[model samples]
Target: MKKIFIVFVGLCLLIQSRAIADEGMWLPSLIHKLNIGEMQKMGLELSADEIYSINNSSLKDAIVALDRGSCTGELISSEGLILTNHHCGFDEIQTHSSVDHDYLQDGFWAKTKEEELPNPGKTVSFLVRVENVTDQIVADLTDEMPFAERNASIQRKSFEIQKEATEDTHYDARVQSLLEGNRYYLFVYETFRDVRLVGAPPKSIGKFGGDTDNWMWPRHTGDFSLFRVYCGPDGKPASYSEDNIPFQPRHHLPISLKGYDKDDFAMVMGYPGSTNRYKSSFGIDYTMNETNEARINARAKKLEIMKRYMGSSQKARIQYASKHARSSNYYKYSIGQNKGLSALQVIEKKKNIEQEFATWANASEERKAKYGKALELIESAYENTQDESAYEYLVETMVRGPEIFYFSYGAKGLYEALKQDNQERVKTNAEQLKTELDDFFKDYNANTDAKVAAALMEVFNNNVTPPYQPRFFNEIKYKYKGDFDAYVQKMFDKTLFAHRAELEEFLNNPKLKTLEKDRAFQSALDIFDLMSVLGSKMRETKADLLTGRRLFVAGMMEMYNDKKFYPDANSTMRLTYGTVGDYIPRDGVHYSYFTTLKGYIEKEIPGDDEFDVPGKLKELYEAKDYGQYADADGTLHTCFTTNNDITGGNSGSPVINGNGELIGVAFDGNWEAMSGDIAFEPELQKCINVDIRFVLWTIDKFAGATNLIDEMTIVK
Candidate 1:
């Protein structure tokens, strides 16, 4: 009863001191107790139970976590049609593209369901429910327990609980810690394995401003794609099969054609990937100096090499499109994040907060004993940035930069089987490698990867110290006379993994001697070995860092008992509500809430890769052929901005209106708010969404994909 009273007081305090309406990403299950009345006051027409319910169909059933939270998608039809950002489905689109049929350059639409393309290993998970499991997880833990031991205990208890919840069911379950381990919640999901591509616009429309205008406002990108989910006869999750039928979902969002006005109510719900709003000043410094710096330096060189190769031929462009996009996206993000952090003075603000908290802690002996040393521990852990810097560089330059090294590492299983002289195991592993070869080599260019390897190797050598460098560097220095290009050329020429035919021949008749002499395989082993060593060296510091963070968060919750607090995002299902509004990004510079098709036409460059306007799209724009998809103003609005909080995994989240109708599809965040993951700037942070009407316009008028549009539930 005493504990219950404390919990109730906490709730009351949170409600009394709620921050700006746009500042939180809230869990759906707790909305009834914590936020429903506030949300209703802000113009929400639906009840909490209508948004999330365990016994009845609700909006939760219509949301999906594509590939388990890499991105979000929404169900638009009862036949399981999915609407997500084109970038979210880029891998599949690129995989099916070739010189003869370049879907990325030209749009693709399935005239019939039979023509819809299948993608292996892709999944879409629907959230079943969420339950607070704090007591079950931390009831037995004590303050005296070591951090490692406490974590192990939590993991064991969580596993037991998850097993019990998911036993005899096809649903998958996870127990995620929240508020820096001060809270815990269980999330169960029903995952479907067979998701297929239904339609996509050409790059000229879908990726319209490309990297140049990625995080900028007044966006004109038609960043949306269509997909469908399939299930077995029992309507359960199943592998891809010819006889599978389109899934029948319990609920789907009704698209709203009526356009929104400024300050109209808006909300977004999706799986936000991660954030560090409660991070210490020391942590922010480390991110700017070490992590972001390394990524920027390494990816700049790698992207340059890829761009040169991609411009060589049509096949080359199709092959490297997805890889280049993935690398360049974060490369630009890191640059923008550094600029925002400095402009916002985030580190200084964090220091002021820490000083205030320290003063509060020292006022009482009891508080001092419980919360003291939190900042000291955090500072000490981050004091030595060398090891962490080296590790970050190694990861960016070696592990992620070069494809050949990691691809060659896939044969480790076959190597182990051969060493054991297990013929059956060897046969199994060999066949597995053979199966993966087609996919890997289909997109891989040996010359391109070899160039990438040389550039990235030079980056690692220049940035990382001698002691932290991978052992393969010794071979480069002595055997290859310190020329990265020479070393990479020799390795590519000699390795069987570089080409499909050579690797297939070796797999057909495997031998231990041939594998042992392979230069690429040996280098892969050394690279991973160094990674393990670096990881082990950081374990103690990592443990201390986590302990300090957890205690600090707990102390802050008690210190500011009247303040509302939200947990950091960790790829969990969350809902954030706000309004469709514009803002002053800088003094004397006002930005509008939305952009129009006229801006897209004005930005077009003839024959340019990023801004090239499709001839058919130009014809329609010249004719003003927007049809019924245009707004009341008789113009097509391309994108709009909202104040709702979101992050990386919210890429394709639905933007819903007060009446619970889909208004837009979220795709990016404004440039001025790149530091939002650490500290939200309500005045500058904006959720950039592609207008739903523009999505419909591109489908019906631009592509004439009426069959695809016919299945949707549109509200005009």
Candidate 2:
């Protein structure tokens, strides 16, 4: 019976490995080759050409890349009204917020086009076309050529291809590799810089379930925001201007107030950030033991300090909301990922796969010559990098964790100009530095940073070996007698950058000697130098590992000719299809696919930070005025789950139904499948999304933004 059970599990694994109709993150341009028939069979109402067509308007025309590629947004109206996740627009909301007009606490809505708030640096890009350019890029390269020479040849050819693709056009072009550099495609994009915030729900509604409920199932977060794209009078991309008009998009999604049913076909199209689906067991073990451990520990300390300070004052809360959210989101994700990876036994599965691959490789001399040493290379790489734990900890704490380092590092160019004795260069750098410092100091809290620095520095000093310690750390240990708190206090009190006024004045009257004498600047330089050395060491040691993994992936593709192989995500737009579904996470625990407003109200704890229900929303719920957003049973759905594959940058991707109508906005993933990026768990993985009707209800009833609602093409 035990042997039978084992065999059954192996069979299940084999079945799962063959990309199911809904399992792969497929290239949209290759849908015909990989997924069109299956998608049509699964109930796709639109043809492949209707989904993606370079010569004509299609669903692809409506989707836009938010802030380059961090998130995605879909056009809801021809007037360029875009719908995306609230957290995707969190930074912009925070930028427009302040103590007096706290847009983050209270929502903002533009009653008219003139009232829309312009975002300076925010931009969105539309995919113009994708062309197969593999032959062009690697035509001259051979397998026997030196790896470095071959890489250089590919890069040089890619540069020429991108240049030709974008020549005499306003489009931006990039060459993306697929199948571990076995294929390449040139993608052209039209970018618009004039994006404006049209509307957003208050934090009480938009971020209702805060960190406590992030990435959890049965979610009730609204998780949606509204923006509009603007362009010049001729409908061409342009910089932000008062004279700019609302962009008339080629196509816009028709949102369906009709919610989905179980096993109903759903599709997601967006730029997913990354995945390591082909990672070896050695890499998995390293991530489990060192990478995740370092991130979890360092972020936990920083988040604790930020929360303490944020809890004390509303101003602090406003200033740190974006920062805190960014830190805590991944802190919790890292924790969940470690748990999921262990619970799913991913490393053990990887080892089994590796063993199978080894056996396959040894069956023939040609296979042995190509793939025999791959696993050894991977194992040697991880084993030789045991010190990466300490290195990563230092990076998290001293380099990235502390804002002081960032501020000082931002002025390195200015320091170099001063050293060069070039007055013109110094003057130019001074203005740039001043502008940068103004932006930095706006959201920065000195007291909070000082506390964080002291805590994180102590953690670094206590854990890192002497040789791995940064110079500033050693000074704290030997000179200050391990009194990190004292060192931090003194540094914060004396650093010119700590006082914006003093920093501005110093920028105005720049001096090389005075700058060099600045302790904070000196500390930043030393830490950056050490980080450079450590990064170089890591790159050098991991070179063979990278090559080996690439070869291994290609070898697997060759060996499994019957199975479809999709490349891991690299922040390129792709499509994933699945269904609205439920799952049993564990025995006797069948989770539902949807959550309603009633569950939301039940989860509310009045006066609690994470689960506070807005008074207006509560009143609307109490009065049973869900408008057109409620079902026949009078319950308004807040969120739902689908099996569509997603990752970090896929946030705000439109969850379209069979008829190519928007039903929800994809936001989070289930905690049970946090390991999906490393190894997809078919039964457990689910994409959590805010129902479109809930989003519309929030805009129409709770916020009374009828003008904004009037702009959308609601398919009721």
TM per model? 0.97, 0.97
- For each of the candidates, give the backbone clash count: 0, 0
Best by lDDT: 1
Q: What do the candidate models score in CA lDDT, each in turn?
A: 0.90, 0.86
**Candidate 2: 10-residue stretch with minimal lDDT:** 7-16
* Candidate 2: tens digits of C-alpha lDDT, residues 437-473: 7579888988889898898887777677888877777
Q: Model 1, range 173-201, lDDT digits (tens) per residue?
A: 99999988999999999999999999999
lDDT of 1: 0.90
lDDT of 2 at 468: 80
